[model samples]
Target: MSELKQTFNSSLGKKLIMALTGLFLCVFLIVHLGGNLLLFKHDNGYSFNMYANFLTHFPPIEVIAYILYLCIIVHAIYAYILTTNNRHARPVDYAVHTKSPVSFSSKNMGLLGSILLVFIVIHMGDFWYKYKFTHSVGYKEYRTNLLTNQTTVTDFTPQTADFEHSQSFDGDTEIIRVKDLHSRIVASFSIWWYVLIYVISMVALSFHLVHGFQSAFHTFGWVHRKYKPIYEFIGTWLFAVIIPLGFAAMPIVYFIQSLNK
Candidate 1:
């Protein structure tokens, strides 16, 4: 137990934790982005609302959600500790500045991470926390005719104050009622300032992932000469470009649509 504690207390151990948590978060991003893509469906948010319902209500997914939250906290705490230690070791900058081999993203990770942290707090508070704990979000009732595959949406009010989601059948029509999280999302994305902040956070995410993704592989000794190119390619394109672009597009597209209204 003492040895385990010592290992985790060491710098190398901290890096290992960061790598594992970082990679977990990378995987989470892909899953999250895929779910968010449902927003593009022109089904009046029926698909996206169902997706959100499953994520929040499914037992296994809820468990994974908690783990994901823990990973974020652990990753951030270790990053802060490591960055502070590195800075304290140097104490002061050298009189003669020289270009370093480290990448720009690598050097500015602390700043990038700080920006992302603030974004996360705002995002979770605005969406996740409210959805889970508060009655601020209204409800949506989707009545679908089984034969015609047609769905009609209406503003829903639960029969009771403590009501959750429900699905039932009235003859051939399926009635589904869930919290209108999609409506909340639409309203938030319609705000210019909110969209601007979301875009800026995505930019920071791109820079943060550009370095962190490859760095995780290096820390794990998974970057063999033959696989180095593959790692670099995935890190640069998948994590650094596609993921951020995909997330940023959500708010940008929504905001643009709002302008047309």
Candidate 2:
């Protein structure tokens, strides 16, 4: 038991965990990006929102999403531990370190990582919590725009004289509100500062992956003269394409919306 614990606690075991989780997250990002890109298609909001609604409510999918969230948390904890250990080991910061022909993103991995961590927190709080906890059957009111430039009425009214209760509104008619998902997303990216921050965070993510993707493989003792190049090439290409496309889509959507308006 002690031997098993020791082996798992070793650096090699942690690296393998990180590499596998990181690869899983990479696939998740692709699927997430594909879903979000639908926001740019104005005619697609009903479909997109319906899709999001289905994913959130579907039992099997919700189970998988929860597991994905757990993976993210575990990955973050492991990364924090690994980084802190590395930092403690290298007690002195070099004043004049030169880049060794590495990409800028590879060189500034720590900075990139920190930015991505912040972005993830904000992203989750804004979307995940709202969708998961707030929109219950009778707990909270959903304020949606039923008409252009007009706020919709409250929909939760009691039946006639069932309104003897303190919280009942017997005279009001039930309102079915409509939501514009794309507009809300575009509004978020419309602010100049948000656009700047979004772009910077994406750049940071790209840089973080530049080193992180292939480095994970090496950390797990996958180092060899022959296969290292293959991993490097594939990792770099995937990072280059995925992060930029995913992040840039929001800004482009906003830009096009601006022109149309």
Candidate 3:
């Protein structure tokens, strides 16, 4: 107990914790983005709704979700503690502030993180809470028979009772789908301001990742002469630029499509 407390109280331990949690979050982003990209599938909401259903229902995934939530809380709390400690350590600032070699994102992690924290709250309230706690109005699933060129529509809700209740279908053309999450996404993105907020938040996320990815490695003492440049490139280009661009594309594409409709 004493050793554990000592490690946690030390500066190095706090940084190591942050690094591990940050990397975990980076992994979570990739998984989340992959799931969200299902929104692009042309098949009405069948694919997306089913995917959502799987996520909510699967036990292992649910466990992971809980872990993810805990990680977020721990990460945020530690961040605040570390920032406070740093501030207390340097009560007197330099009379003249000079620009350092550190990137802006590195210097302003707290600001960027605060913005993301707001975004997460809004995002979870809008989607996660609605999907998990509230009753969705249900959605329609369309099935078309290639042989007869006949189309059939089925409606069902995402509530626990309704989701458990099964419907019987005799014809091959009949396909039952639950609430259309894709439509919900489209509806949300249709609002210009919502899209703007999403875009701006994504930009902040990009900047955060640019610094965080490399910083995590630095914290782990992996900053070698030969590998440092490679890590920087991966952090700056792949994680920072490519990943966020992919995420930004979802909102932009959906918003544009909503405009045409």
Of the candidates shown, which would achieve the greatest lDDT relative to the real structure? 1
lDDT of 1 by residue, 84-201 (tens): 8999999878899789887889999899999999999999999999989998988999999999999999999998876778999999999999888889989999999999999999
Residue range 104-158, candidate 3, lDDT tens digits? 9999998888888888898888888877876663566667675786666566545
TM-score of each: 0.97, 0.74, 0.90
Count residue pairs with overlapping backbones in model 2: 0
* Alpha carbon deviation, residue 59, candidate 3 (Å): 0.7
Q: Indicate whether candidate 2 or candidate 3 has the larger TM-score.
A: 3
Give the lDDT of residue 2 in candidate 3. 98
Instruction: Provide the overall lDDT of each model, using Cα atoms, as 2-decimal numbers.
Output: 0.93, 0.65, 0.83
The model with the greater TM-score, 1 or 3, is 1
Candidate order by lDDT, decreasing, is: 1, 3, 2
Clashes of each: 0, 0, 0
Model 1 reaches what TM-score against the true structure? 0.97
The global Cα lDDT (0 to 1) of model 1 is 0.93
| Residue 233 in model 3: lDDT | 97
lDDT of 2 by residue, 137-200 (tens): 2211233343442323333443442221122222343233222333445566667776777787
Worst 10 residues of 2 by lDDT: 161-170
Q: Is candidate 2 or candidate 3 better by lDDT?
A: 3
